[model samples]
Target: MTLLQSLIECLGPSNVLTDADAQPYLTDWRRYSTGCAVAVVRPASTDEVAAVVKLCAKYRAPIVPQGGNTGQVAGATPDRSGTAVVVNMQRMNRIRDIDVDNETMTVEAGCILAAVQQAAREAGKLFPLSLGAEGSCFIGGNLATNAGGTQVLRYGNARELALGLEVVTPQGEVWHGLRGLRKDNTGYDLRDLFIGSEGTLGIITAATLKLFPLPQTQHTAFIALPDFESATLVLNRVKKAFGAALTGFEVMSEQCLSLVVKTFPEQRMPINCQRPAPEWFALLELSDSEGGEHRRDGFELVLSDAMEASEIIDAAVAASESQGAAFWHLRESITLALAAEGKCIKHDISLPTSRLADFVRDVDAMLLARYTGLRMMVFGHLGDGNLHYNMLAPATLSKARFEQLEAQAQALVHDQVVARGGSISAEQGIGQRRVEDLRRYKDPVELALMVRIKQALDPLGIMNPGKLLA
Candidate 1:
């Protein structure tokens, strides 16, 4: 039987999609990368995934493991060759086990991140791996990318939260390493090897994720600041005052919030009445074991000190849960607003919190000077030093013209990032989009080690070809 027939036989015709049926799996979330695939197969179990991998290996066909297709870097998208099989894992959406006593959850790779969070909540625990795409992104993809989200400040990235993983090797062998033990000193940390490898080494079939105690109360606040420097000062203040209770510190420039307000009239900035809006706004979240009154008193005390020090100009604490959600909606809506504006140049960068203000001041000046009329919509999780430094094409430029300028803009931003000792791709993995940038910016020795690992794991180069290494 041909490869397509074999896939269909293994997964059934309904699960094995082809032609028009497979189109939805071809494109990345941002629609920045689209490719062709021979077929898209939805495997319902780890055994089914291993079988599909074996079939692909027998045919010398490449295998692209995909989750919910909500990746920012197009890491899950196949190549233009149309010779690869897209292994879609949505059908494997199952919570294999939840050990509440051990504070761990073993879930299939296709489990939606939001579902995982909800399951943990139902169990009276917390899974703090959250992102804007959590509603659609999968746990497998989150692990593959070592996703860092808002709460990464306190709990840590996906890699830190995962105690174990069940991965299917490129050779079609299942390595059942889902041990929920917090301390395991094995010969080689194979779990860490595959966590952020972007599927070049192996397919992550499932994971055993770490969990935390649910907070008694969560307080969200919207604070206005004069500049990024003041934002950092406020961040330091809260870090000291709240200690581990401070869960999130996200900062957005006035331009970003303005775009949100303009694009969605229903959403308004918390401190919009000022004659001139604050240059920066911060979304602060505190998850406390204490009660509402205690959390509120502590939150107000810090803000009051910040105001005394002139670190923050205006602040609005959410009076209720709905109001808190509305504040987050404003922050999350910036991306949607940018998408509506037009073509954009997006950089997922991270730097030392000390240099963030200087990096912004210098890069903003450089870009505006070279490319007149460029609009900057900057925002990110300040606590973790990750910024979504995005820019929109000038309204005067045509789509084609704007596309041509993308490379130059990226060079300017990435060059500055490297000079400041920061990373080009922060939370987002180096998918097809930044493969070249990875080559240019990554240390030569480190790059060589990565290549060697990939070669040892996938010698045939049939697993997610032309990505990460290339």
Candidate 2:
């Protein structure tokens, strides 16, 4: 049998998927790039992965590395060629080690992010990298994208949480660097090279991740803000008051909140009393080593001071864990709620914290002028200046026309982002979807350097082609 056939048969029928069997896995999570692959391979161990890669390399077959396939930017899907072999890492899920004493956990690439968080919690530690996709996204994908979530204000992104990595290079050689050391000061930080490369440089087989002490108490509150400017003011106030204890500060528009309530009736808003939906809302959370009583008092005092300063319109604090979770649930469900709407244009862009309010105003104004009656849903980790500025078509526009204008809409949005000295693609890496547009924002020198690195690592251009640098 041929190498590809041999690979499919050796990996077991269950682990190896192809044709109709691989249909679901071949497509992008957002259903944007519906590509076909020769096969989707799921290896349960590092050795098996190395063997598969070696076979693919011998056959000169391109590979698309996928984990959880939960990415929004079509990063994990294969192209339409139907010649690429997709390496799906979900079967490799395993938490190898949890060194509480060292404050680190070594886990396989395929492990779901939520599972890792639960493992840390069970060890009486905290794994703070969080997002709505935590339940379905894999740690490998998070590392590949350098994902930043709500708690980035406190802990940092996946790149910061990563201590070491075990990667399978394009040549099918396994580079094992899963050391739990905090400060190695090695010659070169090679692990970082692959972290945000979106599986172009290599396939991340596993990683040694940093953990933190679990917060003994957490206080969550939902507050109404006059606008994005006031949301920024509230964030600054809470940061000054609580410092590192201020764990999460998210902002949402009244339109976004209203959609969530209307779309998902099971979920309830967190306000103690209802008022005309304010222009904007903020989800503020605080975590401390102190007990619940101290956390409650601290959060309440901060809100009172902010209210006195007129930074907030009104607020409601969570009285119990369930209540706190409910507040977070509303924040986390924002994307899903918005997805229920018809055709949408999504932009995960970032600007300086100081420029965010102005940037939003200008972008919103520009888009409204170009696309009349467009419904805007702007919300995200306001603390870190990353907003999921998405626009939905008015009920009048047909889905076909809405999709056809996506390219033009993206160009407009990206132009504004570049003019503001902001990133066109923030948390989400430049997968195939944004590869061409990347040139508009990326410096030519930097792009050339990236190309050189790709040449050096995957000289044959066989490792996850048509992604990131393209």
Candidate 3:
């Protein structure tokens, strides 16, 4: 039998899928690209993964690594040649170890992010990285994208939480750097190279993720603001008052919240008032130490002072855990709720926190003026300056026509972002979707350097071709 047939048979019928079996994972996130692949190989262990990679290298067959398949960008999907083999990592879902003493958890790449968070919580610890896709997204994909979430204000991004990694390079060699130690002054930080490489440099098979002590107390509050500017003021006030204790600070426009209530009737808004008067709202969370008597009082005091200073119009703190979860559900449901409306041109960009208000105001004015009746749903981790600025077409525009206008709208918005010293793609890496557009914003010198590195690591250019770098 040929190497391809041998691989399929050796990996087991359940693990190897072709044609109709692999169709679900081949298309783009929104069913955009309907590519073809020879087979989708799911390996349950690192040894099996290495063997498959070696076989692919011998056969000179291109390989596409996929996890969860929940990414917005087309990074995980393969090309149309129908010759490449896709290595799906979902079968390797396992939490190998949770070392509380070392403050780290060793997990296989296929483990779901929500599972990791639960394992940490069960061990009397916390894995603070969280996003809407946490339930379905894999930790490997999270590390590959170096994902940033709501708690980036308190904790950091995925890159920050990862202490070490075990990657399978393009050459079929396993680089084991899964050390849980915090202090390691080695020559070069090799692990950093693959963390956000988006599977172009290497396939992340497993990772040793850093964990944090569980917060003894958490205080959540939903507040109403006059506008984005006042929201900024309230953020500054809380930061000055609580400092590192401020775990989450998110902002949402009234239009965005209204869409959530309309899309998901089961979900309720936090505020009990009959009418939604505020143009903007903020969700604030504070995590404090054990027996922290001062946390709740301090949070209340800060809000009172902000109200007295007119930074905030009104606010409500969660009196129970269920109430807090309800408030967070409103924030987490923003993206899904919006998706239910229609086609959306989403931009996850970041700027300096101090300039966030100005950025939003300027972008809003520019888009509204160009596209009449356009709906801009703006909200995100305001404390971290990363805004999920999504533009929805008017109900009148068909999906096809709306998508046709996407490129033009993206250019207009991205140019303004570049001029303001912001990133074109913030938390989301430059996958197939934004590779070409990145060239417009990146410096030629830096772009050349990245190209050189990509060439050095992936000389054959078979690993995740046409991704990240053009």
Give the Cα lDDT of each candidate: 0.92, 0.89, 0.87
In the range 1-470, model 2's lDDT, one tens digit per residue, is: 67667786669878888778888898787788888887899999988888888888888888899999989889998888888899999888999999999999999999999999999999999999999999999999999999999999898889999999999999889999999988899688998999999999999999999999998888889998877898889898889888999989999988888889899999887774456668889998998887748668877998999888888889999888899999888888888887777677899998888999998888788888888888889899988889999988876777778777777888888888888889987799899989898876799999999999999999888888888877
What CA RMSD would you report for each candidate? 1.0, 1.3, 1.4
Q: Top TM-score: which candidate number?
A: 1
Model 1: residues >4 Å from true position, as ranges?
Answer: none
lDDT of 3: 0.87
Residue clash pairs of candidate 1: none
Off by over 4 Å in 2: 272-275
Candidate 2 is scored at a TM of 0.97
Angstrom error of the Cα, residue 283, model 2: value is: 0.3
Rank all candidate structures by their TM-score, best first, as comma-separated numbers.
1, 2, 3
lDDT of 1 by residue, 178-258 (tens): 999999996899899999888889999999999899989989999999889999999999999989999999999999999
TM value for model 3: 0.97
Candidates' TM-scores? 0.98, 0.97, 0.97
Clashing residue pairs in candidate 2 (N, C-alpha, C atoms within 3 angstroms): none
Whole-structure CA lDDT of model 1: 0.92
Reference-based lDDT, residue 64, model 2: 94
